[model samples]
Target chain A: MIGNPQSVAPEPSFRDFSKLCVHTITTKPWSVEEAAEHFAMSGIGGITVWRDALANRNIYQIGQLLRDHNLSIVSLCRGGFFPNLEAAGRQAAIDDNRRAIDEAAELGAPHVVLVCGAVPGQPLTESRKQIRDGIAALMPHAEASGVRLAIEPLHPMYADNRSAINTLGQANDMAEELNSPFVGVAVDVYHLWWDPDLEKEIARCGKNGHLYAFHICDWKTPTLDLLNDRGLMGEGCINVRQIRSWVEAAGFNGFNEVEIFSNRYWAEDQAEFLEKIKHGYLYHS
Target chain B: MIGNPQSVAPEPSFRDFSKLCVHTITTKPWSVEEAAEHFAMSGIGGITVWRDALANRNIYQIGQLLRDHNLSIVSLCRGGFFPNLEAAGRQAAIDDNRRAIDEAAELGAPHVVLVCGAVPGQPLTESRKQIRDGIAALMPHAEASGVRLAIEPLHPMYADNRSAINTLGQANDMAEELNSPFVGVAVDVYHLWWDPDLEKEIARCGKNGHLYAFHICDWKTPTLDLLNDRGLMGEGCINVRQIRSWVEAAGFNGFNEVEIFSNRYWAEDQAEFLEKIKHGYLYHS
Candidate 1:
C-alpha cells in the first residue's frame, strides 16, 4: 500500500544534520579531502562522492578517510550513459559503468546513481531500450560488488542529451521491469517537482520498495542555464519540505542528499556556502 | 481511437508553403508590417500575430492587411494567465483574457492560444483549478464572438511560472472536462517534443475533436537561456517531420505555426532568417 495520503503526510521538521548528505559536486570548489573534512566538521551525516573527485586518488584510502570522519558513504555520483548509435559505443558506456560500480565498491558507497543517457535526435524509445539493456548487462557485476544502481530520472529539459528517463514513473517502470533488488530509483525533487503525478509515483516507488535514494535541490524561476544553474533549497520555488514529507511517507529513511550545480553558488566561498546549505536544510527542507 | 501507431505513421513531405505559418515573435527584428510583407511575399500561408505587435495598431485594419496579402490569420499569439494568488488578480486575468478573445475576433483569427498560467511556489493543483474556472468564465464570450480558445501546454521547465499545464495530456484533460467546441488544445513541438505519450495524446485530442492548433520549433542542446533560446526546425534535436506525421495522421490539417523565440536569432537579418525557416520547413519539417 502507498503509506500515508499526501494530504495527511506529516510535515517533517529536522533540527539537526542527522540525515543530511551533500554531493561532492555541490561544492565544486573543494577537493574531496577538503569536502570530507569540512562536512564532517559541520556534522553532515553523509557524502555522495562524484567520480571526478576520485581521479588520481587511492579510492580505498579515500573511503577510509571518509570512514575516519564517521561520514557514511551514501552513493557514487553517477554511472550511466548507456545509449549510443553504435554497439561498440554502448559497450564502452557499459564498461565505464562497470568501472563506476567498482569505484563505488572501493569507496564504500552502497549505490551508483545512474543519470540514464539519451542520444540527441534519436528516438527516445530506442535510447530507453538501450538503457534497460545496459543496466541488465551490469546486473551481474553490481550484484557481485554489492553496489546497487539507482536510476535518477533527470528533468525533461535534459531529455535531448542528458537523459531519456525524465520522470519517476518511467524510473519506477524500468526498475520494476528490471526486477533486481540491486536496481532502484533516486528521487530528486529538482527534476520531478513539476509532475502532477509526483505523489502517486512516490507512493508507487515506495510501495514497491524501489525508492533507494532522495536528492534535494530547488528550481530557480529564471533558470538561466540548461545545466549548472540549480538553486539551493528555499532559494527557489520547490516545496522541498513537502516533498520530503512525501518521501518519508513512502518509507524512504535515507540520506537527504543535497546535490546542486550552480555557477552562482560555486563562485562563493564553499565553507560559507555549506553553512547556508545547512540553514536552508533546517528551515526550508 | 488513435489515428496511427507511431511506428507506421507516414513521413510528412512538405514541399510547399501552403501549410506554413510564421509567428510574429519568430522574426523578432521585424515590425509586424515588415513581417507581414516578407512572409506574404515568401509564399508563407499563414501568420500568428502576437499581442505586442498590435500595441497601437487598429486591430481590424491589421486583420485586413494580413488578408490583403492573402495570408490566413491563424490564431492570436496568447491569452491565458488565469492563476493568481489574489482573487482580484485572478479576475483581472480573466478580464484580460476576454479582451484577448475580442482581439482575436477583430483580427479575424479563429482561436486565441492560451498559455495557461502558473504562480511560482503555488501548488499546481490550485493553479490548474483556477485555469479551468477562468476558461469556463470566458466560454460565453468566446462562443458569442465565434473565436475558440486553444490551451497551449508549455514545457515543464516553464511550469514554475509560465504555465501549470505542461503536457498535451494535461491540456487534453482540461479541454475534455470543459467539453466545449470553443475550447481545444494546441500541440507545440518545442513544449512537448520530449513527452513519451505525445503521439497517443495527439491522437486523443484529435479523436476528442480538441486538437485546435499546431506549433513548430526546435529545442537546441546546451540551450543557454531558459527562454528565448529556441532553434529553427532542423537546427535542433526534435524529429519535426515525425511529430508532424503524427499530427497529420490524427486528422489535423491546420496551419503548421512556426513559433521560435530566440535572442540569438533576433540579432540576425530577419529576411534571411525567413529564408532559413522555409528551407527548414521544406526539408526538416
Candidate 2:
C-alpha cells in the first residue's frame, strides 16, 4: 500500500532535521561565534557563511568557531560574478573567482557557489557566453583547490545585471561545456520553482554529475519585492516537499540549505530568527 | 539573402510603430469603443477587450465599434477558471467559460483565452486534474461557439490560487489530452520568459497547432508588485527581441499583444500609454 506513488495526501513534515544548515544571512547581524553557538545549540549540523560576513572575522577565527561549535561548512556564500566590459575587467573577475575557489578550499567547504554574472554592458546571450568563458578559465584552479564550483542560476528578473544563467538547463549546458568535474550548479528552489523543465533538467544534471547543491525556500504569494519577499518554507505557494521529493528522486542526497533574503526576517533578533528557522524546519517544512 | 530569416534586431521607435493592438486594460476606466477609438487614432491593427469592458456595450455595439474603427479583436480578455470543490462549481466555471466563448464569437474574437483555475482549494496536482476535466467538459461547447479556447499558463507564483497549469509544457500536455481544435494555450512572454524550455515548448506548441496568441511585456527587475509591476517592453530587463525571434521561428503569426500591468503605466495618459506601447513595438523589443 505504501508503494502507491500517486498518494495525494500532504507530505509528512521532517521534524528532526538535525542536519539543517543555517545560512549566514539568516542570522544577519550575529557574530560568527554567536552564529556558531546558536547552530551548536540548535543541534543543526552546519552553517553557510557569506564572504561579506567573514570579512571582519579572520579565517582562523571563523574556522575556530566552526571547530568549537562542531559546525560543518555545507558550502561557502558564492564567488562567481564573471561578466565584465573590458578583457582586463573580465580577467579581473576570473582572478577574483579563482581566489573565491581558494577561500572555499581553505574554509574546508565542499563547494564555492557561483552566481554566474549577467550581461556586463551588452545583451544577455553575449554575457552568458562570457560567463561560460569565465568558468572555463577558473575550472582548473577550482580543480586544483579540490573545491566544487556550484553555479546558481539567478531568477530571470536578474538576467540583465545579476546572473544571466537563469535556468538549470542553461547552467547544465555551460557545466557540460566546461567539462569539469568540479563545476556544477546550486539548484535553489527560489530561483528555479518557476522552471517547467526543472525535474527533467535535474535528471539531466544528475546524469552529468552536475547537480551540486540544493537551496530550499518558498516563493510568497503577492510577492511584495522580487529580491526580498521570499517566504519561509511551507508558508508560501511552492510545493517544497514535492520539490524535495523530485531532488531525492534525482539522486541528490544533500543539505536542504535555507537561504532567505527577506527584510522581515533580518529585522528580527538573531536568536528569534534561528529559532523560527528551527521551528519552520520542525512543523512547516 | 533577404529570404533568410531576419533575426530580431532592436525594433523601430514606438512613434514609428504604426501597427499595434491595444489590450483594453491599459486604460482601465475606458469603454471598449473608447479603447478602440484610441487604437484607431494610433493606427492599431486590433484591440483586445475584457468581458467587463463588453458588458454594458452590447455585442452589436462592440461589432459596430469593430467596424467603425476598422479594429480586429485579437482575443477576448479571459474565460477559464476551471477547478472547484463542488461538481456544480466546476460546472459553473465551464458554463461561464462557454458564455465567454459565445461572447468572443459574437464580438468576432479569434480566441476566448482561458486562465485555467488552480486548486479548488486543494493541492496543485489535483487542481491540474480538475483543470483537465474542466477543459474536457468545455471543449464541445467551445467548438460549438467556433471560438478557440486558448489556455494561458500563468506564472508559477499563481499556481495555488489562479491557475495550476503553470507551464507551457503542462498546457501542451493538457492540450494533447483534450485532442480538440477548440483548446490550446496563449504564449505570454512575461509568464513564459523565465521558462528554461521556452524555445522547445514554443516549438512544440507550434507543431501541435496550439500556439493561439502571443503576449509581449517586460519583467520589472525589482518587480514592485506581482500581479502588476510589468515593465514597458524595452524599459525593463527581459530580452524581448530574442524571445520574439523564437516565437516567430515557431510559426506563430498573430497579434503581438502588449499586456502591461504596471501601476506606473496605468497612471500615464491613455494616448501616451498607447504611444509607449508603440515605442515598445519599435525599440528595445
Which one is best on lDDT? 1
What TM value does model 1 have?
0.95
Mark the regions of model 2 whose C-alpha exceeds 4 Å error after superposition.
A1-17, A120-123, A194-196, A203-209, A249-251, B1-19, B85-88, B120-123, B194-196
Per-residue C-alpha lDDT of model 2 across residues B1-285, encoded as one tens digit per residue: 233122343434434333356688867756777787777877788777788887766886687778688887788988878878788889888888878888888888878888887652266667888888888887787788788888899976676578877778888988888899888889888887766678899999898899988888887666677687788887665677778888789888777788877788788787877777876777655
Per-residue alpha-carbon lDDT of model 1 for A1-285, expressed as tens digits? 334332232234435797999999999899999999999999999999999999999999999999999999999988999999999999999999999999999999999999999998888999999999999999999999999999999999999999999999999999999999999999999999999999999999999989999999899888888788999888888989899999999999999999999999999999999999987887678
TM-score of 2: 0.88
Per-model root-mean-square deviation over C-alphas: 4.4, 4.1
Q: Which candidate number would show the highest DockQ if scored against the true structure? A: 1
A1-285 per-residue lDDT for model 2 (tens digits): 243232233344544555688888777778777788888987888788788877855685677669778888889887888887789989999998887777777777889888888652256667888888888888788888898999898876676578988888888888888888998888888887756678899888887888888887777766677678787876776666677778878888878798999888888787887777766665454
- The C-alpha stretches of model 1 lying farther than 4 A from their native spots are A1-14, B1-14
Model 1 chain B worst lDDT run, 10 consecutive residues? B1-10
Overall lDDT per candidate, in order of appearance: 0.92, 0.78
What TM-score against the true fold does each predicted structure earn? 0.95, 0.88
Q: How well does candidate 2 score on lDDT at residue A150? A: 90
At residue B41, candidate 2 shows an lDDT of: 77
Residue by residue across B57-91, what tens digits does model 1's lDDT show? 99999999999999999999899989999999999
